[model samples]
Target: MRSYHLSHSGAGLAGLTVRTHDAPVPGPGQALVAVRATSLSHRELLVLEGSYVLPVKPDVVPVSDGAGEVVALGPGVEGPAVGDRVMATLFGVEHLAQRGGSLDGMLTELAVVDADSLVPVPAHLSYEEAATLPCVAVTAWNALTGDAAGVRPGDTVVVQGSGGVSLFALGFAKALGARVIATTGGPGKAVRLRGLGADEVIDYRATPDWAAEVRRLTSGRGADRVVDVAGILHDSVRAVALAGTIACVGFVGRTAEPLDPRALFASGATVRAVAVGSRAQFTAMNEVIAEHGLRPVIDRVFPFEDAPGAYAYYAGGTSFGKVVIQGAGSPAGIG
Candidate 1:
C-alpha cells in the first residue's frame, strides 16, 4: 500500500514521506477500505505547525476526511459489506473525540478502520465530493442546526471567507430557506460566492468593517446566525442579532484582535466552538445532502502521487473550496 506519512522535517508539505509499504490487514471488527479520494483539513496543517491539540505522530497517515469503497472485512464485521461506498466519521461517538489525531487516518491507498466509524456516502454525490464531507460539511451543518436556536427559514446567516465550511454553510443555510451573506479577504471573489447562493458578498479588505455592512444588509437587525471561520469574534458579535448564535468553526484568518467580554454579553448571542460533530450529526448531515442533492465545491483534485502538491495547494490559502487528492484506485465514475 502506498501512503503519505508525516514526519518532523519542517519542510512544509514537501517534508511528507511517501512510501510503498505492505498493505495493512484489517483486524477484528474492522474493515479495509480502498480510499477513492481524501481532502485536506485545517487540523492536518495544525499538526504540521505543531499547534494541534495533539502533536503529529511520526509515520502516521495524516488526513481526517476521505471517501472510499469497502474491499475487505475482518473477523466479526457484519455490515458495510465489500463494495459499499463509505466515508469515515471523524468524530468518535463518545465525547466527540477526534478520530485522526491518534489513529492512522485516510491518506493511504487502503485504510483499515473500525466498521462502526464508517457511514454510507450520500448516493447523489461523487467520491470526490464525499471526500469533502467528514469534516467541513458536517461542521457547517452543525453550525446551522446546532442545539442552539440555529438559523431557520427566513433568517439571515453570515458566513466568513470562501473556505469549505463557509461555502457549505452558504449552501445549507440557503437550503434551509435562510439568506446567506458571505465575506472574503480576496477581491473579486464575491461573484463566485454569489453564484453559489450567497445573497450578499463583502470583501473584508475592501470594507474593513464588513460586520457593519452585514448589519446594514440585514436592515439593521443583524444576521440571525454567524459562521465565524475567520476568528473575527469581535466583529461577529457586532454582526449577529440579539440572541443569535455564532458558530466558531475555525481561526484561519488569525487577524482578529482580542474580543471584549462586554461586547459578547451585550449581544446575548450563543458563541459555540464547533468541534466538527457527532456520528449521528454526520449521518443527519448526509441525509440533508442527499435530499437537497447538494454537491460539495472542489477547488482541485490532485492525484495520489501528488499528495504533497495537494497539501501545498491547501496551504496556499487561494482555494475557494475543498482541496482533494484522488486515490490511486479511484474511478472516474465514483457515484
Candidate 2:
C-alpha cells in the first residue's frame, strides 16, 4: 500500500513523504478498508512541527479523517460489511484513541481499523465530504449540543474562523435554528461566511475587541453559546451572556493567555473544553446533516499521489475550508 508518513529526512512541510509499504491485513475484530479520501486537520501541522499536545509517532500515517469502502472483515466482524461505504477515526470508540497521531493514520491506500470504529457514511455525502467529518464536524457538534452548551432555537452562537470546525459550527448552529456570529481574520472570508448562513461576520484583525461586537449584535445580551476555536478564553468570557456556555474547541491563535478570574467571575457563564465527540454523537450529527443536506465545504482537493503537496497547501494558511486528498485512481471533485 502507498502511504504518507512523517518523514525523518526533513522538517516542517518538507517532512511529509510518500512511500510504499505492505498492505495491512485485518485482525480479529477488524475491518480492512480501501480508503478513498482523506482530509487534513490543524493538529497534523502541529504534529509535523513537534508541538502537538499529544505524543505522535515519528512514522505514523498523517491524517485522522477518512472515508472508504470496506474491502474485508476479520473473523469476529459482522456489519459495515464488505463493500459498505464507511467513515472512521480512532476517536470513534475510544475518545483517547489517536489514529494519524500515535497510531498509523489513514493517509494510505488501505487502513485496517477496529471494526467497531467504523460508521456507515451518510448516504447523501460523497467520500470527499464524508472524509471531512470525523474530526472537525464531530467536535463542532459536541460544542453546540454538549451538556453545558445546549444551543437552542433563537439562541445566538459565536463561531471563530472560517476553518473546518468553525464553518461546521456555523452550519450546525444554523440548522439547529440559532443565529450564528462568525469571526475571521482573513480579508476574503467574511462574505463567504455570510453566504454560509452566518447572521453577521466580524474581522478579528480589524476589530481586536470583536467580543464587544458580538455583544452589540445580540443587543447587549451577548452570545448564548460560544465555540472558542480562536482560543481567547477571556474574550469568550466577555462575549458570552450571563449563564451562557463557552466550549473551548481549539486555540488557532497559538498562544493561550491565562484567563482573567475577574472577567470569568463576572460572566456567570460555564466554560467547557470540547474534544472530538463519540460515535453516538457522530451518528446523530450525520442524521442532522442528512436531514438538512449539509455539505462539508472543500477549499481544495489534491490527487492521492500529491499527498505532500496537499499537506503543504493546507499549512499555507490560505484555505477557507477543508483540504482533501482524493483516493488513488478516484475522480477529482468526488463530492
Tell how far residue 98 is off in model 2, in angstroms. 0.9
Task: Name the runs in model 2 displaced over 4 angstroms.
Answer: 7-11, 92-95, 332-335
All candidates' TM-scores?
A: 0.95, 0.95
Across 1-335, the per-residue lDDT of candidate 1 in tens digits comes to 89888765243565688889888899999999999999997877887676777544566678889999999999998778999999998854345445556667888999988899999999988999999999888899999997657667999999988888888999999999999899987656888998999888999888999989998998899999999988889999999999889899989878888999999999999999987887788998888888998999988999999888888888888888999999996886468
* Full-model lDDT for every candidate: 0.86, 0.87
lDDT of 2 at 320: 85
10 residues in a row with least lDDT, candidate 1: 91-100
- Residue 108, model 2: Cα distance from true site in angstroms: 0.1
Clash pairs for candidate 1:
none
Pairs of residues clashing in candidate 2: none
